[model samples]
Each structure stands twice: as C-alpha cells, then as structure tokens.
Target: MIEFKNVSKTFTAKEGTVHAVKDVNLTIPDGKIYGIVGYSGAGKSTIIRMLNGLEFPTTGSVTINGSEISSLKGKELREQRLKIGMVFQHFNLLWSRTVLENIEFPLEIAKVAKEERRQKAQKLVALVGLEGRENAYPSELSGGQKQRVGIARALANDPEILLSDEATSALDPQTTDEVLDLLIDINKKLNLTVVVITHEMHVIRKICDHVAVLDAGKIVEQGPVLDVFKNPQQAITKRFVNQETSSASLDDTTVVVSELLEKYPNGLIVRLTFHGDQAKLPIVSEMLRQFPDVDLSIIEGNIHQTQEGALGSLYIQLLSEHHDSLQGALEYFNTMRVETEVIKREQ
Candidate 1:
C-alpha cells in the first residue's frame, strides 16, 4: 500500500518559487490499477517521481509498505528503489545494449548469478512477446517493441510496485491500445500495483479501477473509475469528462435545443437520462403508451456501457395537443427512477 499524507513540493528558481504539488492525501490499495489524470504542468509527474525517491517532498510524508521514503538516503534509498520500478513517456533504452543485455543490467546490479540472469531475462523476453528480438538493438525496433523492452527491463528485479508516467503518450492509437492490454496482462499475472499517469480519458476507462483528477497541483475529484466518469463533480473534472474529438461541441445545451427546434417546430423537447436499473429501452415505449395523446421522437442520444450497467441519454420531442399530460409523463419518469431535464418548449 502507498500513502501520501499532506504531501507538498516547491521548487525555487532564479525568478521565483513554483508550487508544483499541493497538500495531497491519497491511499492507493495494493494490487489494483490506479490512475492519476491531469494536463501538463499539473504536477502529476512530480507525484510519480516521489514514489521512487527521485524527488523529495518539501513537506509532509510519503509512506509505502510501512517505510517512510523521505527519511531514507544514500545506500538505504538505493536499496529501497530496487523494489519499485518505473517506465516513462519515452522508451529510454540504451543504444549500446541489445534487448537481452538491457534486461540483464538490473540483475547484474542486484548481484544475481550470470546464468540466472540470462535465464530470467529469456523468460521475461517471452513474457513480453519479444522472444525473437532479444538480440536486436534499440534503434532497430519499432516504438511498441522498444516499450516492450522497457517493460521487460523494469520487471527484471521483480518489483512489487510499477509506476507508468505517460507510457502511451508517444504511441499511435492502435499501438496505445496494444500496450495497455499488455500492461493489464502483466498486472493480472504478477499482481503488481500499477499507477498510471496520463491525460487521456480512454486510458482510464480502459484499464484503471480507481482514478484521481489533478488540476493546478491538487486533486479536485477522485473515486472508482466508473463512478467518477458517471458523476464528475468539479468544473475541471466535468471538462475532462465531456471532451470530444468530433467537430460539434456538446458543452452547450443550446445546440441540442436549436436542432430540436429546427426539426420539430411544434413539440416539447426534453432530455432524458437513465441510471442503474432504469436504463431499459422499454421506458421510451412505455412513456409513449402512458400518454396516448403524446407523440415522441428520439433525436440525438447514445448509450454508454459503464461498470455498473448501461446508462443512456436521449433527446426526445413530444408532439401532442395536451401539454399537461406531457408534463405529468415527465414526473412519472422521475418517480420511476429515470431522470428528465427540460431543454426547450414549443407551444
């Protein structure tokens, strides 16, 4: 387990002092994938460095498995570092060493026998799906292959904890997914405590069980991955959650309203969301039947598969002569545990 108690860090420069990290308190459970998400300059990198004693905190304490990391120094700190391994945004491979030789470097430092290091390195090469490339130099391999070599080298000492600092940022989308799957496999097989730092939301949704959102050197919101994505609290958290790559922006509800008004000129437009067990598609049909005078049309929506269950959003327009019955129908959905928000009305 890893615990950060009121941890803060500051850097003094010629111009002024920079507060890189605020008073962060977090508890990372053992044998689970934890994610730290933030944009550049959010101090996420500083937090990861503190895990392995690369950077010391200005105040507060960092404890891992009952040992205080800030208190250790010299050979004691170096000895402790062997039990924790880290990977970076870049592959960071030694150009002079072959894949097998690079994997053997850490074992040599730990005083493992020469024959044992070779055998162990060979096994790891097979584990990372690089059995045939063991003799290749770093320059001869692709980006994904080089990262695999880094993974093998980090596991050479059998560290219980693994820290990944934007490990997939340099790879393409397809390559990123492949690397993420490999990390998931490693975590399951070795039960390694993996902490990943990245700004990509897909990374969190893909493999992380728990997550923390950092902004301006402080965690604004955090919890289980599914829960945080479903109900993000802070403005920074909401911005990350609602981000999209499409040409249209969904941040403004007016876009939805304008589209509805352009298509259905004389109807009631409402936004419907379902959480937990109330996310059944039959609710749409049921609402239409209950209010026979009302005509409903689904405009724009999508169903997201969350860890809890299927949650969905629907932009619906109701066409009817009686508006009072339509209003009651909205309340009916509310009583049935489905959520409704009125976007626009056309009388």
Candidate 2:
C-alpha cells in the first residue's frame, strides 16, 4: 500500500512562500487503479513528485509498503524510485533511439546486461502491440504508438507502481481511449498499482476505480468512481462530473427541461437515477401499468458504466388530472430504490 499521511509541501517562490500541497491524507491500496484529478496548479504534480521522492513533503511522510521514501538518501532513493516508473505527458523519448532502445533505456540505466535487456525489451514490445514497430524512431511513430513505447519502457523495470502524469492529455479522443485500455490491461496482467494524475475527468471516468478531487491542494471529495459519479458533493467535483455527462443529462438538463416544461405545461418533470441493476429494470413500464391514470413521456436518458456498475439517468414528464396519482407513482419508484427528483412541477 502507498500512503500520504497529513502531507503538505511548500515552496519559496520569487513572490512569496507558496503552499503547493496542504494536509492531504490519501491511501492507495495495492494492485488497484487510482486517479488523482485536478486542474493545473492544484498540486497534482507536487503530489506525484513527492510520491517518487523527487520532492519531499514539508510536514509529513510518504510511505510505500511501510518504507519511508522521503528519508532515503542517494542509492536507497534511486532504488526506491526505480520501483515506481513514470510515464510522461509529452512522450519524452530519446530523439535518436528507436522504440526498442527506448524500452531498454531504464534497464540500461540499472546496468542490466545488454542481452538481458534486449530480450526483455523485445517481450515488452510485443506486450504493448509494438512488435512491428520496434525499430521505428520516436519521430516516425504516431502519438498512440509513442505512448505505447513509453508504457513498455515504464514496465521494463517491473515497477510495483506506475505513475501516469497526463499521459493522454495530448492524444485525440480515440487514441486516449486506446491508451487507457492498454493501461487497464497492463494493470490486470501485471497485478500492478497504477496511479493516474490527470486534469481530464473523462480520463478518471474511463479508467480509475477510485478517485480524489483536488482543488487548491486539498481533497474535496473522493470515493469509488461510480459513487462519485452518481452523487458529486463539491461544486468543482459536480462541474467535473457534469463534463462527462451528456448535455441532456439530469445533472445539466436545464434547457431541455425548460423546453419540455414549455411544451407540456400541465405535467411534472422528474429526473430518475438508477444504480447498477436498477438501470436494467422496467420500472417506468411498471409505473405505467400500475398507475393507469398517469401518462409518462420519456425525454432524455443515458447510462454510464464504471468499474463498479452501471449508473443510469433519465428524464420523464408525468401528466395526470390528479396530483395524488403523480405522488403515488413517485412513491412506487422510491420503493423500488430508484432515486427521483422533481425537476419542474406544474404551477
């Protein structure tokens, strides 16, 4: 397990003392994909730097499996860092080196024999689906190919923890998904712990099992990816969650709801949220059958899958001559464990 206990970091800049990180206590269980997401200057870089021992925490400790990394000196620190490999954002490859050489670079630094590193790099080249491109230089490979090489190289040392710092920020959407899928495969195959540091919430939604939302160096909200998506507490976190949501989603359906309300002014508009298996249930159909006096119109809906399960959001307009029928239908949905919110009630 990796842990940061009451960690904080400060810097003496040209202007004044700046606190890069403040009172962060985070735990990352072994063999799990974890994500730390925040905008620029939110201390994400500082946190990762401290984790790899490149920078020490000002007031606390960073420990990986009971070993204090911050206290280590010289050789010990170097060895510790080797156990944690970093994948950079810009594909920081050697201009002259080919893919295989880039994959072999770390092992070369560790002084592994030339033959041994060659064999290892070859195997990694195949592992990352770069077998045919092993001899291609960084300049020749595409963005995704270069990232694959970067990943292969990070795994050259068989790191226990992989730190991906904005590794996909520069890639297109399709390539971003491809890289994320590769990381997931690597995590499962190697049983390795992966820590992704990104500003993109979509990156967090795509790969991370657990996430922490950072703002101004503090953790505002965090939990399993599915939980946070279903219910985001902080304003920043809600904004992040809303980014991945469809424009017609329940989180930001103001315009859609307005149009629906204007067109069907004599009804109640509600937002329904379904968790896991609930998303698959025919609750709305059942509502129609059981509450015959009510009329329901499905507006917009979407289902998002996370590492945990499926989270579904739907918007519907319920119309009835009687208010009790609408309330009864809502109560029925409540008993079925579907979350409901009345978006706009007829005035």
Candidate 2 Cα errors over 4 Å, as ranges: 247-252, 259-266, 344-347
**CA-lDDT, candidates in order:** 0.85, 0.90
lDDT of 1: 0.85
Give candidate 1 regions above 4 Å deviation: 244-282, 303-347
Cα deviation at 297, candidate 1, in Å, is 3.9
Report the error of model 1 at residue 303, Å.
4.7
Please provide, for model 1 over 1-347, each residue's C-alpha lDDT reduced to its tens digit, 9 standing for 90 to 100: 99999999999989899999999998999999999999999999999999999999999999999999988999999888889888878988889999999999889888999999999999999999998999999999999998998888889999989999999999998999898989989999999999999998778767788999999989889999767866678998867766521123564555667767877666778777776677765887787778888887766676665435665667778888887888878888888877776765434
lDDT of 2: 0.90
Candidate maximizing lDDT: 2
